[model samples]
Target chain A: MSQNVEPFKGLKKLNRKLAKLHHILKRDINISTVSTPTNNLVLCNSGLVNGLTEDQVFEHFSKHGEISNITMLPGKSCCFVSFSKKDSATSAYECFNGKLNISQNNRPVYLSFVEEVPKPSIEVIWNELPPGLLVFKNFISTEEELNLLKLIDFNHEQCGLLKHRLVKHFGFEFRYDINNVDKNQPLDQSVPTETDFLWLKLAQIQPEFKGFKPDQLTVNHYAPGQGIPHHIDTHSAFEDPIICLSLGSSIVMEFKKDGTHTCVLLPQRSLLVMSGESRYDWTHGIVPRKFDIIKTKLGGYTCLKRTTRVSFTFRKVLSTGKCECFYRSKCDSFLNCNIEEKMAVQLEKMHVHKVYDNIANHFSNTRHKPWPNVMDFVQSFDSGDFLVDVGCGNGKYLSNNTHTFEIGCDRSANLIEICRNRKFEAFLTDCLSIPIRDNCIDGVISIAVIHHLANESRRLQAIQEIVRILKKGGKALIYVWAHEQVKNKQKSSYIMQDRKNRKGTKEMNGQCLTSAQQVSLDSGNITLPVHSNRSNFQADDLLVPWKLKGDEEENESVFLRFYHVFKEHELEELCLKVENVRILKSYYDQGNWCVLFQKM
Target chain B: MKLLTHNVLTSKCIRGVTVGYPLLIKATNVKVSEVEFKPDFVAKVLPKIEWDVLANAAESLGHWQNLPKELPNNYENDTDFLKKIHRVLLEVEVIQGELICPESGRKFPITNGIANMLLNEDEV
Candidate 1:
């Protein structure tokens, strides 16, 4: 099959429209363009440019030689540059919304370099590159310093290399001890030594990581044929770049690039920063293999033997003190109660993952803007109805006026301001403490907010808040994540650590640290949730975190055992339990379990 | 109204518990109305529907039994199968009775043909 046939259609159409749009937009507005008559600089002819649509422009760009990188701004034009050689770095000199301008038909095309563009300057410190972008020389020392030749069980010895990568990329250090290594063990059982934590501390020393920290560092040990499946890192609790440091073995980190395979070998001691495409766009996994002859060994040595490999994947979570949504009771009726067994199980999984993924997707997508669902919802409501939006991330729904009188509350202030600026009444409040008086609002809506909150007390508190704010007979449209919604054939849920005597479920082990614990911890090269309003929970547990207090029991946090799945019977039961709350309608919204209730 | 819901609905959760839950309808029991096709809506619902369960339910009901075993990307015309699907999933309303759970085997009967799922504490 021709690669261009099905895949590039959208891009093709986009290019054509863009070309036409550029011409029209140029005529419609005065843009500052700089022109120099150079034969090497190929500018489209006026008539051709005028008549050209977006598709033609794309075709033109496609035909105009090999395009290395193409990016479109939020404006009418897009900029792409072609390199003369493979590794030759050529800057566009601040094109589009920058100082760089192009003269077309005796008119300068307007581009702004005043804002949102990197300032052009010669290098002082090569480290001066932006936080996400940096290059360091001598990142790793020679093999003698590495002392690899003198070690047994090369996997444990290789922790030094992994530490080297962490310091180079994430500005962290690690430590490992041979005694801690469980040699000749299963993939998940092998443990990282003190060097791992030492590298973590090195990463912490970086000024950029200040205040942002890591609570969990999942050490995944891989042998041949052992691999992780297609899945997202559970960052709903934290917004950070998952830093992965590879050691001992060479494995291909298979990344999905626009649905195509883009395999990159993670060589020994090589630090691969996975974010953006690697994080959001593609899933990463290593195919189980004993021998990887593809990668060259460190210090001109021949290929090394594969014993076992360890990866230290670290992240920082932005805590939401109280989970906005949660299932109050497990559907225990399944064993004893009567229901469609298959349907019940399927539905239960659907609800669990549905809520989980939806909430995650919503936050992931809207982290930079307002929630997109608010726009669709506001169009249905009238102005007079007092609307209460629960878990309103930065008030995207409230900002746009469908109804004039609306109260949007969220845990994150950064998100609230985004909504508040849009014209909706936004507040930084928890779902439980709903700032509004009881029986005040006409309608209440919570979308994709409940699943992140896996605590029962918090979920109950939020429901009560929603009930208290709404007027008698007011409508409540609440959406929950369904189970098994996240499907990537490659997911592997290996036990991280099994602490048998732990108070909580086996799933959490003893790793259940409060978001507050995340503070003052070392995050390996991961971004913090500064822009998110949900990170407030990282600071406190009783007030913003909304958990129980004052007793030894308060010190213990609940670890998720079984997924808090909802059965049809359980849903009906819940509807009955919430006094004066009647079920209005229930349906699936984009693979989620949505229930419409009314305060009667 | 969809046959997919029908396959899952049984008179088993509670006495009248299945009432509104499965909210029953007679074979020749309800009204079928025609609405303009919305491809977007159909696409949205496609992933949510259980194909096997829907097909079995359609076959048992004897409506649109000729539907292709797999879900087609696009349907050109409103075939008997399509109509049946549309009718059962969207239009047919249970004017009365409870929907029972196939696994739990409890009776949730419908009153006024409306299934009421409310149960006492002992049952909960």
Candidate 2:
């Protein structure tokens, strides 16, 4: 009778009976058997997975089902995904078995169902955060907060706008004009005595901060839709463990480092302590918006509305000195671990000579007019006296004195060609090794050249080369760019002070100070921004940009030239080391330290 | 390169190349142009030149005709001898040549009146 029925309908009835039998068998099996089906488990493996976190594993496998748990075996490069619903697991296994394409480190993943599942190494901590960040909820009582607010004199006249918020500083005046705390200069007004109790209470909350003394307090008032911009507290300006207590509202602050973003909630009457990596490496800020959208576990966002808030940030001013932190990248004290001498030489060759070669034509065009001081030196030599110009780019000084028999030498072959084309005597050589016999030339002029050398020793070597070639009583002039000539007054003062600090310990040769030196020495105690107008002037040892005339709009094509702007005493010190050379004259002319010395 | 410039050129500045003076000239191209004669300049420059080396260099370039094999005792006042010295020092140019260092045997090339005295990194 079954064979006589419609054949397709009879096949469908038999398949349903088989499916029911298999389901009953799977439900009845309790032992780990090969044929037993697991609906809520998925097995994942990859050959090249590394450091795959639990959150990443969830992000990848959650689309298949509502993942109840994910245990990652980083050592084995495998993981287990458990779904909340059996049907979702079945669907995922059916769709992905033997055809899953998940990959890490360019290695494809394999997915399948297994008869036995291995135990996970450890349970993943779901909401663990990075170190060096602390947040306390409702840290102060309502009455205490009201008393603290009363102690603060909210004077609109004194509150200045720092970005989007109104800020007033106590103990140390945080200058918004300079965007840093002024440690050397004390403010006219001091911290109010009414807040003395609040300082003691903070010390009680965190005993480690008791030594910090809470000398500097910046009261910031933020209305709705107002927040501070991202910044790391200046490392040299303050000691560690900056404390901020919030009042009257809840807000979300974002912390970022490298590319990772961590959102922290600062609730009303909360205290946040930032130290260690959080204080130095991470930049913290609040976005100026009416609402903040936070991601939920179900891949949805919940917005938190903003309200007016006030915060008091307390810090201890760091004493002025070098920061000897092991974290070299973030330390603000030293410029860098003293650059190796060989590496410095390599940098000079790569940044200076190579750049001159690339911009030989354009550089020659801009360097047409010889400096008047250099011209005077070239013209001082008597006619028929043999002279050489070291680092003589394009031979600008070569033809300045037709009376003298002059020859030019430069490291750039292209510049040598330009000199040859102009029928000026020239040679291709390095300044350190001039290839000229000793005591042969009457005079040598090196203009705007020695500063291209990266280290003091190399600069001295260049000077020695000129001295070696000069005859007894022969004269030479050297010009180096001065650090004191920056166009901006504030920046120039900073550079001047930095130079003085670096040169303070060295004994001066009892030389009288010029008017400019007098001014810089008088202002040596002040501290200012070390990195201002970086586009025009980089570090003391840095690659500065040179814009080509026709390609000014294309920033990528700009050539980087190396320079070590010389301080006045530094140039004089170098000259003093060359034996038998007396400093005939030293002066600043048009942004260059010009020194004229005679080989005795 | 004029012999006057060659007078001051040496390979001693090159590391490992001691006794580098008196470079042997092998000129493939040579030319002579008139330079204003200055007898006093020649007289003053005479004490600085390696006389034997200059004479050898001039002979190797096949331009030593009428030149004395040895520097004369009274040449300071002899205009004829000073003229020859001037011609070799200032007028004659080695348009294309090689200057071989005697010690290291390093050859520096000269082209279009400019001598390439630059050294390799290791040599410098």
Candidate 3:
């Protein structure tokens, strides 16, 4: 059976290669030369290399090998270099071919063997374009095109030179100093009165763009070998429906989106309106070439040679805040509400409970000493008062006030057992639904428990439960871990170290704290362990670690416990939800938010 | 589980049990170990406990004696009566038993002085 499987596996590999070859051939790209070896001549097919002289080509290629000759085709914006030896050509191809930042302009030079020079073919036709693209041929008469061109001074000395194209801004001075369109500063020259006629003509042609009174216009004069780089107009900088009117010569503009490509031909005196998906999602650019081969409906191709061309690009500056488009992927307003809910449940079951269970013994070991502030609150109750210590881990506060009947309760069975072993009155129950009667407890002390609730509503519910269990005028002391544990100066250093240590742990607990709260703790070696399964960590939740003493077989074990450290105001806000509870005092102690509230 | 803890316990958290207070005790095994008598603690907890429920639970466990059907006017100062209340509330522990919810008949087991009142997901 093994021998038979080997032959079948070989057949599968052969079938996959054949399928890939079929796809490449159907795309009409050069397949023969791409697969076969070639001579010692290499062709630079980049449009950027049109202005390079023979000396410039020799200077760069000579480093790889002894160049016999260099031929520069200025008309085609390409160059051919022949090396004296085959190895030198191979070395040059290996080092520089298809690599970016090899020339002065830092543009990638598309290098290929001279024999494998790919023939031009239309990548995509007009009908196959993505939605929100409309192109109209002969949108304006030849006389109207000539009249529009006459309004702009093509040979103006102040015209900006972008690569090989001549550009002039009408309403705003498009600054070349910055790569993006300048929106903060206004240009000295506003839109010319003559250009108003062209705007009116555009409105007459496309009624949808009638209300779009564009305040910015950029006229570009491109020579036969010049072209613009592929780019999507900044969504925040410009309004939709950018109009580009082509004049003097026809051209093919390529639109690319998420690995799919489409091309549309703009005939002379034609107007192309880009809005919606085409304006925001797809990138449009033109390849600088002397000729373009377009596919016709009859399954044939027609070659259109290039000449000097002029284009008018009109745009309206965005006059609003962030875009609120329904296409969230393309817009900036993409948020998932379902993921937030899932995270809350995961934080409880997976990180909080699982980690506490694993480190129950070790956690009890560290929690031996009760805080001084909590001890004071316990003693405040009368000698015979009945108090319940909610989330009373290891019964730390259970025996604090011997005179008062203090009952400890915790969700962890292991921790509850420890409480019972110490002879402290204890019970097992969830904080959301305690087994006790309402308005029965004289005092409730819930220390370091509320923060474990990952969701805001659940945190509020926990506080509400405490209020419900308290007797009228009964006081309850609640404590939650604070986000900012350490003071100001050491904050950044602590967070960096915390992140470094968190990477080594298997499970992450709560949300991540803000930068200010991420201060370094005095115990430098101690850092929280983050959960390994969860990805979203934008919140102030964290996983604290507990180190366990190991037996002879193992050294030491680290367990991660989930905690949602509270902001000072967060605990106060949660307490505000309980109807009858009046906040007596709220303060921060030992990096924990302590709130003392009483039932009315 | 002492009658004091059972006095505050309820099965209302269980499904199909709207009124779950005063759980019916069906004791298979019970122990009465004497705990320290705290007269003030017993007096303070008296108001919080449901009198009828405590009386019913104590009677079901066969531990009721000298417990009044109604509270005496001078109960706080009644030391003899307070000592009896303390014994029934804290000293009388169910070593091994079962507590049945009167409304839903859900049984919570008791073993080694600890009562397991946790419910299954479907039961809750």
Which predicted model would earn the best lDDT? 2
User: TM-score per candidate, in order?
Assistant: 0.26, 0.54, 0.52
Tens digit of per-residue lDDT, candidate 1, span B35-116: 4444434444455455766665555445544777888766535454455556555554443433445445454443322333
List clash counts for every candidate, in order.
Answer: 91, 0, 12
Predicted candidate 1 versus true structure: per-residue lDDT over A31-122, tens digit per residue? 22223311112222222233323222233333433333222222323332232322221222212111222334333222211112211122
Supply the global lDDT for candidate 1: 0.41
Models ranked on lDDT: 2, 3, 1
User: How far does residue A24 in candidate 2 sit from its true spot (Å)?
Assistant: 43
Error of 2 at A360 (Å): 3.2
Estimate, for each residue in A347-442, the C-alpha lDDT of model 2 and write its tens digit: 667668888998999889878888777887888877568989999999999987655678899999899999989887789999999998889899
What lDDT is reached at residue A455 by model 2?
Answer: 74
Error of 1 at A172 (Å): 21
- How far off is each candidate at the interface, as Cα RMSD in Å? 17.2, 1.7, 1.8
Residue A331 lDDT in candidate 3: 47
Docking category for candidate 2?
A: acceptable
DockQ of 1: 0.01
lDDT, model 2:
0.70
Tens digit per residue, CA lDDT, model 3, B1-124: 7788888777887877886887878888898887778787888878777888888888888888958987777789999999988888888877778878888888888766666676665675
